[model samples]
Target chain A: MSAHLTEIIVFSVLFLLVSGMGFVAAKWRAPTDMAHLDEWGLGGRSFGGWITWFLVGGDLYTAYTFVAVPALIFGAGAAGFFAVPYTVVIYPLFFLILVRLWSVSHRHGFVTPADFVRTRYDSPTLALLIAITGIVATMPYIALQLIGIEAVLKTMGVTGDSAIARHLPIIIAFAILAAYTYQSGLRAPALIAFVKDTLIYIVIIVAVIYLPYKLGGWGAIFEAADKKFQASPAPGDGIILNANNQVQYFTLALGSALALFLYPHSITGVLASRNRDVIKRNMSALPAYSFLLGLIALLGYMAIAAGVKPLPGAKPGSVDSNTVVPLLFDLHFPPWFAGVAFAAIGIGALVPAAIMSIAAANLFTRNIYKEYLRKDATPAQEAGVAKITSLVVKIGAVAFIVFLDPQFSIDLQLIGGVIILQTGPSVILGLYGRWLHRGALIAGWAAGMGLAFWMLWQIPNAATGRKHFGGSAFALSEFGFDTPKTIYVGFVAVLVNLAVAVLVTFLLRALKTPEGVDGTAKDDYFADEGDPRIARRLPGTVEKVSST
Target chain B: MAEPESPHADTKPRTDSSPWNWLLLVPIVVPLLTPLFNHDEPRLAGFPLFYWLQFAFILLGVVTTTLVYRMTRSRGRS
Candidate 1:
């Protein structure tokens, strides 16, 4: 820590600045009352185009964008670029669908996706299942963000020989994050998103332009990357996709794109918007971050061109590939600038972690606590429970890093996408209509999750030497095919989920199984801001005025 | 039977569904068809076809969504 004083100081200053902003963000919007879920968990649901743009962008792109994508590109070649296509398609795919969600959520006072599920289907059991799945899926994702900050810390020589010393920085960082999120709720990340995005854009733009100029041109970088892959023994390592992995690339891209907005954090960001137009306008605007992300993915190849090696892992002889991007900046840029870059990655982790915890907490509060634990809990009590749950969620994420191997978190994130995608037939499909019966939706979810786990159990990561739950790209040969071509696990699982849903819906209809009440109307999906129907039900306005 | 809520007794005709929503499919489908642009030839500034084409897809997505937003904005309220 003493050797790299400049980087540490610079990183510390920017980090402390954001930490200050996080604490002060409690008053940024100065909500009329913070005791309501609308204010505490959803930023008062008044975010307009610009704030929604930054908040959602910050929530989605994450440290995964800055650290993980480039690391994957460095390790796997063109396969890593799947994130580009995944993000490129996410906006257009979710553009119209999200507006319907926005309009309805505002109209119904829904705080979590499970809240919407509960009200839409009128089934507390199904809503509880959705809420549990969301919390389980989100825990690993929050853990992944810690790995991002740890990668940056390791690069700056902040790591130590002992396990406690090595993980101390991450714990302290998350403590600050948990504290501010507990105090400020969703607004902490919303306010700090502005600073996080500005720093990231500056860092990424400079790294792309200046690094390429310094280490030969873009042509030279690609040439060096191609040359390295040619001699590499790994089948997936190439400057372009090959036959064996092309299907995996396409399916992974499509599957991830579909799953992107389904995450509770993503919905948290969306539901916090002011209205439908904010979501619509943001669908067009958010892809600007994808352009930056594509450039960031290329930093992997740039790391190869510069011959930047990853730092040693906690285990002997293993390398932490997530450090590639940080090491690239540390090797090329001056200490002060590198510190800024590290701060960008570190804070990048915080915004999503905060949003994800808030999202998970909201799920617990609205769906679990309100539905089962305390049916008559007041809005203030719900807010208090959510705040406490947010702290526990953050602590759970920290324990995930401290007690378990970080590799487990990575595997859980891969499984997280598959788990969250199961909610599609219930949540996403439920938004359009209620043709699928509630019993069928539950059966479909069970089938999807079971098949996804069984499939994931077969994949073995040769690099990590993990036998089961190794990775997401399951081979086609598992079905007795005579080929090495593989497909994404989630993609295959979701198709089965939808198929099972349709089949079960028909069978259940034939059996005359009763369907539950859908509390929403068709026009509810189309209602926008200032709609009399929506304005009347919005939480803070109606309930507060009536009580007063 | 789960009837419509009393608040929605005055149901308006559904005019918000637009054909322009189908245009959004262009961005989603074109990007997934990797066979069209997955190649090493036609490099742009040293970016292989695969790399540069994805950047183009981002632009395509933005343009298509923006177009749909403009066209569908008025229809929803009417």
Candidate 2:
């Protein structure tokens, strides 16, 4: 392999630096005890505004911003800019939803979303399902972050014909991530995120300013991208959305926005904030990152103008579009700066991957292991389980990359969005009040998840030659419509989920079926940091799951 | 441990359920209106109406949410 020795050196040094930070983070804000779920999994839940900003931004904006968005824009044209609107709309929803969740979570000492669900519905079965959904959805997302790192590595000329050679560096990177995360818990990512976001802001600001000026100008870049799209045969390819994909773009944007905070990682970030005011302020300010994402998406058009080609895929004759952004940087930027850019994307992947694994681990330990395996498990044992689970979760994500080899890493995330959206009826709706019966919520989740998977199974990615689970787009023709309009499967599935939930709720109420006891009262949702009515817990421990 | 009840607590002190919170809907609905900006005209600095308008939507979201937060934060725990 023709490795760029200079680029590799720079990338390795920065990566090692971040890994060191991850290890040292255990002492950053030393807790009295590290052997409890709240202290270990939620970073002591005392983050002020700036740390919350960096950590949440780092958690949400992710490698998806640096690697996946530009790659999609390069490959699919304007339809891919759905990421811009998706991020734009989330803050409004965040302001309305997250503050309430934070207050209630802090009030009751809930560590995961399923922890909230368990008390709200008073159904261990429903909470178990939510926990499983979060774990399953988060696994692919953690794996997608590896795709970001893999793309950068491939661009640095670290490749081999053998599978082990292709994945060895990624395995090494994640292993180090797992080690630090196991030691430091959420603090590891919270500390590293500051470094990650600063580097990203610098890299993106320079690329947007310098790259456009160097490669003619923005007009030439757009013109070149338009010209390429115009010559392509794909109906979805263009500078602007066509009639057929316009609905797809809107629904994809809206569906993805709805699904964003539903992921356990997003909730983990929100709950870790010190108070409701931090969440409220951050929700307004977080849209600043959306502006950065808009500029990042345009880098795809710049790639078109720069004529940056993707590197070869693991499979014969297949190209990995995930490599597009890294290849663009390698082509245009100076060697050292390009290495810095590569490090920015690689480190970007690590932040969310770390947060996501911790989130999933929390769900497993709280919802499953403690609930079923050992009902009286102490806080120390719970933290121990979560730490071990994080390692196992990272290993599972590594296996996803090494084995599955999906055509596009973004598709892995989209599939995750659909799976996680099924939990909305129980989790998000339950926040308002427990109007929907526990049985109805369970039925709705099953219906939504079933239809979402079935629809995904029918889509075939013509590029990858995969027969099923190809992509998230569901053709209207599948329902016998004689048109070319396609819609986001998650959007359609959630609608059915809500309808079934409402209809079944009416039926169950009419039949006089007894509902589970809601462990929270209305005032609990409004409880703040100093509220005495809230549950009092030991400094390091999570409160017991309130099973009525 | 129950704290002493204050005299003002009898009125169901719902300071957070304010009218200003509804203004947050503007940012959410305004961006979803794709026809408002999805076009080739009015390109700014090489960005199409589609591209530049999306950035404007981001600004719209920030301003609207900030206004809501500023108006609502003074009243209750939120």
Candidate 2: tens digits of C-alpha lDDT, residues B12-70:
54436789889988888877777887799989988899998988989989888888888
User: What DockQ do you compute for every candidate structure?
Assistant: 0.56, 0.47
| True-structure RMSD, every candidate | 2.1, 3.0
Chain A TM-score per candidate?
0.98, 0.97
Candidate 1 ranges with C-alpha deviation above 4 Å: A408-410, A535-548, B1-5
Residue-wise lDDT of candidate 2 within A1-548, one digit each (tens)? 34488899999999999999999999988887788888899998889999999999999999988988998899988988999999988999989977778877887789999988998888999999999999999999999999889999989988676889988999999999999999999999999999998998999999999988998999999999999999998878898988788778888898899898899999999999988889999988898899999889988999999998888887889998888899888988888999999999999999999999999999999999999999878788899999999999999999999999756889899999998999988988888878899999988999999999999999998878888888898899998999999999999999999999999999999999989777776776776776765445556334333221
Q: Is the docking of candidate 1 incorrect, acceptable, medium or high quality?
A: medium
Can you write out model 1's per-residue Cα lDDT over A61-108, one digit (the tens) per residue? 988888888988898899989998899888986786877888778777
Stretches of candidate 2 off by over 4 Å are A1-3, A535-548, B1-15
Model 2 lDDT, residue A470, Cα: 87
Clashing pairs in 2: none
